[model samples]
Target: MNVLSHADSALSLLPPVVAILLAIFTRRVLLSLGVGILLGALLLTQFSLGDTSLFLVDTVKGLVWDDGALNSWNLQILGFLVMLGMITALITVSGASRAFAEWAKNRIRNKRDAKLMTVFLGCVVFIDDYFNSLVVGSISKPITDRYYISRAKLAYLLDSTAAPICVISPVSSWGAYIIALIGGILTAHGFTESGHLSVFVQMIPMNFYAIFAMLLLLCVAIWGLDVGPMRQHELKAQKGELFDESKGLPPGANADLPEADTGKIIGLFLPILALIAATLYFMISSGADVLAADGNAFSVLGAFENTEVSQSLFYGSIVGFIVTLGLAFAQKLSMELIIKGITAGARSMLPAIYILLFAWSIAGVIGQLETGKYMASLVTGAIPFALLPAVLFILAGITAFSTGTSWGTFGIMLPIAADMAMGSDSTMMLPMLSAVLAGAVFGDHCSPISDTTILSSTGASCHHIDHVITQLPYALIVALISIVGYVVLGYTASVMAGFMACCAVFAVSVVGLKYYAR
Candidate 1:
């Protein structure tokens, strides 16, 4: 296989653009993504049929097996997804989901509290967005289901909170990755007076989209400020239509299964707790091992930077699955039923796995085309200093949206943002970097191909397209506010001012919408 690099041309935009537009209009995500992958391979192989076919085969094959070895990261993620599905299925079969829902029914008296519970859980699980996205959904879905909250809305809460919280938390995978990247960028540009950690801490307030999006989600949940497609979903939910089964359920949902009256809530709590504990333990231990190998002291933050997130999640899920099986057997579930549950669970995850596989394929194709690089190149020279942050925000958003990866957007745009700040106004560096983070998240929330977006929907048991459509209007609102905030910060070079401006605008918007609903 040849090492494919970026094409460095406008043609790089064609695949993702066509794929995104097709997904939006046709609502056939797999087909749309497949078309995009095909188009990219054609372009990459210069339309040679044999070469393009080989490239496509190699791309898919590399997902699990590459260079005579297992691709542990990708394989582990798939393993975790299946393990989570199995856990959820066993819980359902044991009637633990119903027991938990009944337990919550007594204390959670209203939809508002139910929605807030989801938000709270989302906030508490901040280690990794992949973990946060799925675990929180599985835990909260039953409570929200009892309250008639739409899966679409549940997914919104999950999606909005997952990345936003991860991006800001210093102990998280997102934080560690960003901190390390910022360290290199700082060194490259001769900004040595401040360390990357301090700079990252300072930029927290400057992350307008992430902060504002959290606030907006809270407002939406508390005030019933549903808008656009979400409003329709909510209305239907109130009428006992929580999910549109016509769109098909994401893998791992056993909502329609019968509940055993003898089951206990502990069945639900114990497995999930075990999963969380095991995951955190692996993350720390693995990271510590790396630090030891490099002769560095083991610190929590250092561990996070070196942690294998997918591998940790995979191992954690296996622990959780074992716990779940123990609980099921203790409940006196027959071997036949246990076997059925396991098979059903694995089968349920197949859809999510397929979508993830194709999504990864297209993302790889996008990388070969240098779509992000081409997009980043558009913002290179001669921008007004006052608009630099704003421009970076929009550019990062577009890149992430088109490429279907926020982290990739950060890799492509952050250094350029650093370079631009260095050349123009070095004092605006943190603000500019913050803007890139904000925009990448903004774009990620809106992109149909984004893995977190897919995971959110799967976790919530909502249709993928439904989650994408319902979340878009809300994401756009935050993006617009963030852009204005960045423009203000760029001109004034004041993180405080920009943050305040974003808060004020968001408050007014939420209040106005509440008033309008009345």
Candidate 2:
């Protein structure tokens, strides 16, 4: 492969920096991403207008079609996404989601119960962050609303669980992507003994941001500890003012189809169960050949290690879509209604799909420019290895924050982080990797331009900026704790001890913030 390269210079930072600034100022993610892509294309073409235009055309075309940059992997992901959209839409159109909501409403008598249910639902939909954000937000919003929970707080619950859960879950899209990145880096460097899945599992304990975020969410929900702007929002919501008049609301998704007369909760539960079962089955079956090649019959972890995650997800989602359609038909839905639901679901995913395409393209441009190398070069050996995890955490956090995409950050940073950890004491490698993953998630949680964040706000029917402002404090607190945890882990190199110490620190910090910081 003949890779394009550019000289390391200040110009290398233009695309991401421009994107970040535009996104923050305009609060228009799609525009920001498009500008970034255009800038990158210009730079890659050496400022030739003709070449940049042609590159843009080719890139846009390639994003959807198979012949260009949208290879098999990209297509598989797209398939999974579309299928998931169809499933979600079908469930909604079938009135299954409404039934589930009504059932929960009867059971959930108070705010605490409502919040707990929201968190629980968010955790349950761990297949993908996008799915988690949309489904949890849509299903839990009405229940939370009846209890006077602010849309901002609901958005927080949705956003907090999305990436944080996905990053740690062994079978999620995020996990699969991380595994692939790790596996590629390992193979590129000729290190074969350390399997990506094994390292990913090991790093789970060290992913302090994700762990702390979930814990903090539960604590906040259980105790009703609202601080910063969130406190104001919650108080106002309690006074029958769910939204601030000053802050304009973002448009929410409307399922215009009429609810079925005989809506049953089973309609929702069965499809979700089917999705989970299908995913596991496909994951295991797809890896069967690889496991046999290694003279192994089956082990749960081993099957996951050998699985073609994208392919498996694609197959699983297809099965899920089929099951959802079957259930809709069983409910005697008209053909027009079913088709409308499928199209509506896929339509809702279009914005996210556009963002992913642009994010990926800009990331490709960054690779060609060796942006990772340039960034890595700034970190010198004079910084003690003991502090490397902390340093890398900050760096990765900034990178992901600016890009508003954790997957892009992982693609750019994991390889460099892996190379940096090579030939060092093995204890340090997992921590460094964990730091990268944690930082990326932290950044994604905070970035207003983040697709997950945007989806969360939409899901909760909150103003976008309100969601960002209210959630920033909580995310920052957790991020600070994660940085401290990484620093401790760096010196201790003991996951157990480090986790205990970090938990102690979190306890003190959150308690103080709860009672005093407000």
TM-score of each: 0.98, 0.83
262 Cα displacement, candidate 1 (Å): 1.4
lDDT of 1 by residue, 52-116 (tens): 98999899998989889999989999999999988988888888888999999899999999999
For candidate 1, the per-residue lDDT at 514 reads 90
Candidate 2 — what's its lDDT?
0.77
lDDT of each: 0.90, 0.77
- Any runs in candidate 1 off by more than 4 Å, and if so which? 1-6
Q: What is the lDDT of residue 307 in candidate 1?
A: 88
- lDDT (tens digit, per residue) of candidate 2 on 295-388: 9877665566577766876787788888888888889998988888888778766655665566667766665666555665666568888888
In the order shown, the candidates' Cα RMSDs to the true structure are: 1.4, 4.1
lDDT score, candidate 2, position 269: 70
**After superposing candidate 2, which stretches have Cα over 4 Å from the reference?**
1-7, 66-70, 125-131, 134-142, 145-152, 171-202, 227-252, 289-298, 334-340, 403-427, 448-470, 492-497, 516-518
